[model samples]
Target: MKNWLNLTAVAASVALLVGCTNNPYTGEQQAGKVGVYGGLGAVAGAAIGAATSSKKDRTKGALIGAAVGGAAAGGYGAYVDNQEAKLRQTLLNSGVQVQRDGDNLILIMPGNITFASSSANITSSFHPTLDSLVLVFKEFNKNGINIVGHTDNTGSLQLNQNLSNHRALSVANYLTTKGIAGSRISAYGVGPNQPIASNANEAGRAQNRRVEITLLPPQQ
Candidate 1:
């Protein structure tokens, strides 16, 4: 069943990529979103097959498109991850709150700065963090990004997700203001599903309420 889903996703991605429209930069058309997504699908399928199944199945599955195709897909994913790693450093240097999670980086904005009581508006002092994100993302030009908003487990799950999405969009808007194109940002909110620290204490709840910036490869 899982394999079936992966196969379906790959086919859908190929069709999608083949149908993409692009704007000319320096009068050159940019396309191939399908290939990018297909690549990711390929890697995910292989990784799961290897970890939970057999090496033979994994190796055989990877040999699908072409020997080099898997490498290309895997390499591209790693390259995007490397950019995220570098962005972590940039965030730290810029004095933003950041935490590293393997390939994903967490940007924590405490309740004191991210939003007003039960509101999604970021505080005035947090402006610098958004500005710095724009700067860093501008510099990291090869990939797209996803901003996920999070909140403490203090409200309805659905409401928190909506609020989180709003916060992420707010950040994305600020980045757009700083010259980054809106199309380059993918924003969402997952509510309180992922929390870095315990929420039983004040400090933990503060840490729980935050936004995450995941530098993603162009949506393929």
Candidate 2:
């Protein structure tokens, strides 16, 4: 997100610079088209920066993502966003600390609510959210549910990935027992690559120690 912000700033700067120039592409220079292009490019650049790791991939993926995004139902997207926000609030009210980013929701419960250092056994305390989600899945079955696990960047990357992966699988397994189709849900442990908070600060580290649930759009 910070990277997105920076790209936006850079884009604005470029737009300002281009406004003062004569258009070489067209015989008669027009600032209006250039401004529109620059503005759009900035927005695209920011989105790309947030979603991709490499420059070329970011540029290509950003354009493709934009086109696909245009085909997405605007009202449906907003409705889904609102539902996700409501779900996040409900989880928070249930005494779970949640991080909401678009359709991706992250929750970090205390050890009492989850498993030990490297185990996938979700504690009894966390069952309520899982059960609640089962109900949510039934109601909003359009999107695929993705269970992801993360740990503070404290352990070996391989071990961390394994732990997170197991944790995700455990929750997915539990959901399957509740009648959710296995194909409707997927799980992965990102380990430290997608930490929302800093690993340096204790408070931030606590935030990093969490599980993520991502909801993807309906398939065609």
The candidate that wins on lDDT is: 2
Candidates in order, TM-scores: namely 0.55, 0.58
lDDT of 2 by residue, 1-220 (tens): 4544554555555553454445456766655333444555556655754487475465455544443332232335445655665666567666566555544444455433577656789877778877887887787777777778888788799988888888888888998999898898889888878777788898877777777677776772
Q: How many residue pairs clash per model?
A: 1, 0
Candidate 2 positional error at 209, Å? 1.2
State the lDDT of candidate 1 residue by residue for 73-176, as single tens digits.
64554565556556666667544566544334556556566678778777887787677667767776755667888888887888888888898888778778
Q: In model 2, which regions exceed 4 Å deviation? A: 1-82, 85-89, 97-112
List per-prediction Cα lDDT, in the order shown.
0.65, 0.66
Residue 85 miss distance in model 2 (angstroms): 5.9
Clashing pairs in 2: none
Provide the lDDT at 32 for model 1.
Answer: 44
The candidate scoring highest on TM-score is 2
What lDDT does candidate 2 reach at residue 9? 59
Candidate 1 error regions (>4 Å):
1-89, 93-106, 218-220
In candidate 2, what residue range of length 10 has the lowest lDDT sum?
A: 66-75
Clashing pairs in 1: 17-34
